[model samples]
Target chain A: MSEGERFTLAEARDLAVKALVTAGTAEGNALSVATALVAAEADGQKGHGLSRLASYAGQVRTGKVKGAAEPQIERLSASAIRVDAGAGFAFPALDCARDALVSMARSQMIAVAAVYNSHHFGQGGYHVERLAEQGLVGLMLGNSPQAIAPWGGTQGLFGTNPIAMAAPRREAPPLVIDLSLAKVARGKVMAAAKTGQEIPEGWALDAEGRPTRDPEAALAGTMIPMGEAKGAALAMLVEILSATLVGANHGFEASSFFTAEGPPPGVGQLLLAFDPTPLSGGGFADRLEILVNALQSQPGARLPGTRRLTAREVAERDGLLVPAAIVAEIKALLR
Target chain B: MSEGERFTLAEARDLAVKALVTAGTAEGNALSVATALVAAEADGQKGHGLSRLASYAGQVRTGKVKGAAEPQIERLSASAIRVDAGAGFAFPALDCARDALVSMARSQMIAVAAVYNSHHFGQGGYHVERLAEQGLVGLMLGNSPQAIAPWGGTQGLFGTNPIAMAAPRREAPPLVIDLSLAKVARGKVMAAAKTGQEIPEGWALDAEGRPTRDPEAALAGTMIPMGEAKGAALAMLVEILSATLVGANHGFEASSFFTAEGPPPGVGQLLLAFDPTPLSGGGFADRLEILVNALQSQPGARLPGTRRLTAREVAERDGLLVPAAIVAEIKALLR
Candidate 1:
């Protein structure tokens, strides 16, 4: 293992697909998961990238994830669809939803898809951006294992629910926004803990309901909700939409996502698509351009997805610097 | 005029209706607008309450808000409805949307109503809460005249652009959430300026785009977005969803809501409703109860709508402390 080893996007995806297939995932599912992971790495979301392969492989091997399960899609209503992930990867279920949504929204003006019995969907922006790229407005909400408490509550009763929204643009890339309800992601705290660094105040509370800078204590306790009570309420909104409405396991009922848990963390997601043409009666592109140009005109003000797009370009040109040890660890999965 | 004057809910509504009728609003429209305003006061949202009656009256008098015009409803799709407000107050249009949303959502599982040519729709929570009370999840988004700039731009190109969501609860009132994308409302800055108080930093910027604590400067300049760029992007999302998608005037094209001069604001709104019975099995109430109890079990943890609900109760029992001067102003309109 060397310190300076780098892998091209293709090389990383190939290695990941090999590891997943070796761990018993079907070829199609493995390819989907690998594409998502490699894209995350290329976009600078390293925590959601290759670093997750080990846990995923372990889950597949332990049968915590049903490697060969096929997603089942049901038409709930004229404009609503439901996909049960069969206790497997979420990408295939999401793909099914997307395929249905794009066509249904064009005809219906708006359509909704609910996904259940799924694993982590990884960086929601990826899925939503796909719809936006096709000229549809996309919104996604996901519920995970509990990491945040309700406003004024000491116990972690809700997940740091994430929401992603994207709207198509004419000239520029789609306007994409992805954020979790927590003030910061738990991954950052975990990373700090690994490096023996103290977290900043206000990021989290200890198990005793007291604010603490210790990353370990923060992880054990609850992450602070973004914008305080407002953020917590928004998280609750997501929980109800993605879990209760979709008939998926509640955050409290789901297992930890970072491990091959006792059972598949039967989480849920909701994706909504809207056709701007029929809904707006045209001129969407011009209006969008006006707003986007106004935003970029400012010196310091940048759109949410700009950084990721820049990183992706860099990765495409020069490849990604993968720690040789992590590469070797992933490669060992095929052994 | 006295300092300690109070008005019952009935009294406030009667006065508002009288004023609107005196200003040439149709009887039914006046009643609708009165109900919304009085309810805002009862819920302690003074900014959106009876204090708005004067501007509403002025706009009607100037014909900027068509006092006698009726909202026209059109079905765009099976689950989508469009309401043209006829340059009138938004309450009537929203009521039309609500009536349609409830019926359409029951049959279709989900429904959306887009409203155009509308004036101010005060306190979006009031609208969504109505749907939640009927066992339906409700979401509302509205666009206003420009008050905040795009993320990095100095010129205000978007409104505070509020969003509201509410989900039904089994044993308690609905869990309601409403927020504006601005760090602080323009009304707050206006009030601060009147009181000669300096606002907290980060709430707004000066005319030249420099941070300023002086409320007057903040009002003359632009509001800071909540959560920085994330908030601005959300505002844009609302602008596109409510205005562009509805075939209404964009935020930059709309007139000030507070003024009677200039053309009708022609702002827009979008309301979405989902029926829990069809979307989720019959267990929605039970699941909602579980989450609500878990949140309430902890000390000091309160849901978003709790405070407003409490205020409504107090107002119902003891009436609202209406400033004698404000009461005089409304009564004068009746003359």
Candidate 2:
């Protein structure tokens, strides 16, 4: 949907829930995933919002994402937990892990949880924010199917690894940064596909090493590393933490959540929670607030999540902007 | 020294140690710091090598970096420890932390350490390699003086915030990725300045938010975030873990390891080590080696630290390169 279209957040959520239900997702699962997507769209991250529906539906149809699967804790220690996602969509797995992490971190002061054998999880930022909202410092990472080339290689060997973190900032919006290690997220390529536009140079490559602007060609080729080698390096680090360490897929074996091919497409995720009270002597939140204030009040510099929060404030006040074309597409699918 | 000039590795280490000792560092501290710089030069990280001596000397003369201060353990838990760096350069602090962490990780299985009030630690990749060389997976992060902006807005609110990790790969070199969150390391600007070269567009901005190619202007300007916002987010995350979590100076309050102003910089670093033996269930190094070989076998992709290792290898085979100019500079400093 374009920016001009409007929808109440509730309406958008309900519409998405219905769509998920129609696609055979369990009611609770449908509601959960639906809320996640709506939350994304409401905050104007349309790249990950409703646009993910068709791919999610396809995964469900192909049994790549098992909505009814239950994630089971595989290993637990005093301060760490590892989960097997039971070949399910990753959101529920991550949710279970994050919830457990908060409880575990309460006593341990820090908790690290890993989710493996899961399908695609969306918006890592949201998960960190959830922990931050509860007054914990949170960091999240996920490794998808290999989609970015390692430095110097022309083929994809690293996922568009997304890392997110959030720290509470009192009245100010939580200082959250959710980012993919890749130069540009693969979603931008998909966005270009839908818009029939060419991506910028240095963004991607065709099957050969040569750069290509065509989204389709770029996908067939490889996504460029964020800045030559560093993006590749960061992606490798993510793979180790989220996949190799978590005992999930690594390298080319990792399958995309949006694609239904290759062994149910398992992915890996990690969530870390740190109790600020221990570190701050109970003044942790204040220290975080001070840091946030420093950034916000600096001569120049925006808080990481400020724009989203600002957009959210406006959306709450004036209703959300939805693309009419996207709404029409959704309506047609529902009918 | 330019690319083809060579010197034996011993000769390089000897010279560096001599120079550091001449600059007033204690013998042990001088040896360690000199070894690190030689290692960086061997690894082909010219920007981080002997090039840093002038600034290091300046900091020492100003008393920002103590010559002989030793780090002491201030707090210890079964799985964690906090060290006070005693106003010394990071080499001493990190050397102590590494030994302590290795000992702890051997028993605890996982150990985390925070070094507070430390100076600029050298190339992060080397630290991880040290841990990896000891057969452990290592993750290290250090937040320097504020040099990076958050995302939008402007002004420096974060440092070049470097994050690095290393994984043992059996007989293969450990897979390592060490990098700064800023699009370009501040050192690159210094290099450009020395050479009178223009930084590429988009790498930095002038003091007023206008983009600039001049190295001097970019130095005065806030370093641009690495990948638009992702870079900023990573830097902020690093600050929290490496500074706030460790109870050290953060953001603007952080003292410049490269300059003389401000109270002794309370630089902090975080180090976490994981036992791959437990994760791999034995023979993990061989499995890791297999993974490394697979990646290396792929055309074009080089392991992150290979170039440095190669440089060191070549330097050892021949001699370490000492530019006539750099030697002249060092000799001049002795008087």
Candidate 3:
């Protein structure tokens, strides 16, 4: 167990797909979910990667997530589309939205997609990158289960909602920026709680709204929003855009993302795509490169998502090192 | 002069328009500019209010802002419009874009407007609120002259870029959220510098990247971003959306917004409008009220923009208090 196992990207994807299929997910749905998880893993986001399979499988088993459900797409208007994820994995719904957006944005110059009743959307950057690769600028926001309190209150009322943006580069991979509203991801606290560890101060508050370093207390309490009140405000903005505007469950009304209990998460996501060519009159690429050069010329300054790109390159060239225990667990699903 | 002055909203607008017109701004453009400034003052945003009229008039007089330029609008696609601000005041350009967007969004369900070659756009919230008043969800981003540095960089290469969002409520005023990327507005530093006052720590870094309290040194240096690295990243996102995508000057390339020197600033803005009725299938209002109630039910928690609403109500009832010196300054412009 001390020695970890390594798998090529293709092998990892196949292994994940097999495990998901064995857990009763439809083959097409399993493939979509597995691809997203593997991509996240390659980008060094273990919190959203293969680590999520056990809970996901349990949820499917209990019908909290309908493993065979297919997303239904509706053309709401000339430039807007709505997708009902049908209580299934979010990857397929996001894929459906991205596919629709690429063509819609090209035709209309700008387009938007709203997806509801979805599960965990692994690594928001993954969805937006697809749009960038199609020569579009992408912006995405999603609401998860509640883990953050309102700015001055003790009760959790909003998710550590995420926002992501991606733009195509002239001669390189797209520039991707993704961030969670919280000072730190709630997953870090959950991991620390499992390991019986104390979290650093300023990350969370206990149930009485007092700062606490104990992971368990923090888990039962709330994660602190980044930039204090400003971050809390942005979280609420995301909540309204991703959930309320789409008639999906509010953060406080959704089930947990970390457990297989109760109803489906029934969360929602909003994605916007713009065709840079028409928007910029054919100047977007040159202008973007100017800003990129300015950023790179500065000492000690680096573009956002560079680390993720580096991780992806190494994983593609060699293989991803996965913990042996988790690999074994994944294999057990096949048995 | 010893007695402070108070002006009704109409009186304030008239005073501002008179000063601007005396300084050679066209009557139409002056009225638009005065309207925005009055709105800012009513919302308690004094930095963007009448305090800016002297500089605005000076810039107009020097031709740093085109006093007679009419914004030119072109429909780029079914869902996008581009407005050439013609190196004129941003308020007029924003007005034209908003007028076009309300109709476009209603037909397309979502629409975007990109305005370039613009002068200072005061209070990003003001533009978005217009869309919300038209029963559309609105988001706006604008980049100003350079005032912030990239993360870990010593030089200022980005503006105190602002982002604002507004949504209509069921039985209340539209919910508006607006913020600058910097921890504090650069105008506050400018004020402190004029008075020979020191600023608070953590507000800015000296030219050599050392933290400083001296307002003059901070003025020549870069303002610290709101949430450290995350804020810096978001600033870059806004810069690309508002400036680069619209083929306008980058933050570093733009001239000062507060002075009558150099060429026109030629900055840019991006505004997005979504018709909520179709996107939400007629459920947006009820869903938003649910989230709003959840926040208000908490004893200490209040909705965003409540302070601005309170300021507006007071100003509307008792009129805005104008400082004697600023009144004198405006009077001098008339002379």
Candidate 4:
């Protein structure tokens, strides 16, 4: 691969699957993970895309993540399901949850799935988009290892918890919104550090709890929560829902997703599906259109998830331009 | 009453109830509304407190809000309930929902209540706190009359929707969070206008869609959504869930809550309760404590709702120092 290699969506997915399988993942599990990663790339979520493959493979090779572990599902209630990922990659667990939740939600009108003992679930929006495509409203919350501190606290105590929500549309792509509680993703600071660039003020703090623009110090310290105290509170809400309510590891107890560390992250995710037909008694689509029309009618107004949907369309049509270095690194896993 | 007048909690509540009753409200209905309004004052939410009594009484007098309407509850499903507020105040409706939701959540693991044909439900946190006190995780979303424009659009298409969430704790007060999707509440601009003070830039835009610092101009324009586009998206989500799903008036259709000239505001509220004991199989309290300990261990970190709880305690003990003008106005209603 040269400096500017590009691959069709299917080509990139196949390569990812092969690399994961060669690095000791079960073929089926590898395919699921690969499909998600490739979708992320296609949707222009570069950080969550093939760039994550090397680290994932390393974790698998190091036995920090069980490459062939099977998720165990339990029916906690008629409308609630729980899945234990057996310290495996999160994609398979999420897939299992989605299947159960969709069926239950259709019948019960609403259903929830709690997933534990899982690894990183990339691109929360992707999971919800699938449910939205099925005409169900989807919600997802995931807890990661600690990155942001509690409000007014200097010590990191919670993850950069992320929440994603999607609602089905009558004609347009589903409305999707995915946001991290932090002002910005921590990966941006790492990228800045690598490029020897300074971060903006208020993006992060130093070890001494003072704001800093130096990316290195920011990386060593804490990311600033979005909306100040309010964001931290929202992060805590996600932590409690995704971890505490699911009996999974607390953010502080979880290992780093970026490293083949001392143990599997044992993080958790919660997914919910709601049948809008039963809840709204039909006309959900029309009501959604009313809001949508008002939104797009104005200049500069754009719905969330539109960018990713557009990116996906382009990638599906013309393919994705992944970096050459990332392609080589993923291929090296096979060698 | 002079410039500074203090009233005991009972005194304040009694005054509110008497005023409403004098304005033609049923005694029981007046009590419920008074209790809620007095609680708001005690909790330091002046916008929703006794200061709102004048407008409420005027609405009752003008028959904009039915003074003696009885809310009718319908069990939509085993885990879902709906309440028609009978074009009356929202307190009675929320009371009905809370009563039904607690028992249903316990039996069903999770339950939801949607209230329609309602007027303003003040201080959403107050409602969720009730559920949290009952050892349930409470989530509430309410749709108000239009005050916020769609993202990138100057037309006010959605309300400054509010969301409230609360999780129970073992020993500490419940962890509660309530936030409006707007950068600032619309009341602040109104208050500023009354004081002839300029608002901060970025708080709102003028009618022409240009940023403005004049409070009067800000009131005439649309609020800047919190977190830019994300907040508008959230507001839309709330609108769909609370109004569209509940078969209530859309934000665009709802009448003004601050006036007595129109029909009932016909707003809506949706509340969900999750019994953590059943969902988590006990140990819910202990797990919550771990995160609470971590947060409080650091100096300066304080949980949401603590300040309000403390304010309530002080108000109960030392009484509330409300404006003499406001107190006189309430008395005038009785006269």
Best by lDDT: 3
In lDDT terms, how accurate is model 2?
0.76
Off by over 4 Å in 2: A1-28, A260-262, A280-284, A314-335, B1-28, B51-58, B103-109, B152-154, B191-203, B260-262, B277-294, B325-335
The residue pairs in collision within model 4 are: none
Clashes of each: 0, 13, 0, 0
**Interface Cα RMSD per model, in Å?**
1.9, 2.6, 1.1, 1.9
Quote the positional error of residue A77 for candidate 4 in Å: 2.0
TM (chain A) per model: 0.97, 0.92, 0.98, 0.98
**Model 3, position A244: C-alpha lDDT score:** 83
| Reference-based TM-score, model 4 | 0.96
Model 4 regions lying over 4 Å from their true place = none
Best of the candidates, TM-score: 3
Q: For model 4, how does the per-residue alpha-carbon lDDT over A164-211 read when each residue is reduced to its tens digit? A: 888898888888878777888899999999999999998998876789
What lDDT score belongs to each candidate, Candidate 1 first? 0.86, 0.76, 0.91, 0.86
TM-score of chain B of 2: 0.92
Question: Which structure is stronger by DockQ: 1 or 2?
Answer: 1
TM-score of 2: 0.88
Q: Can you list each candidate's DockQ?
A: 0.59, 0.38, 0.77, 0.56
Considering just chain B, what TM-score does every model have?
0.97, 0.92, 0.98, 0.97
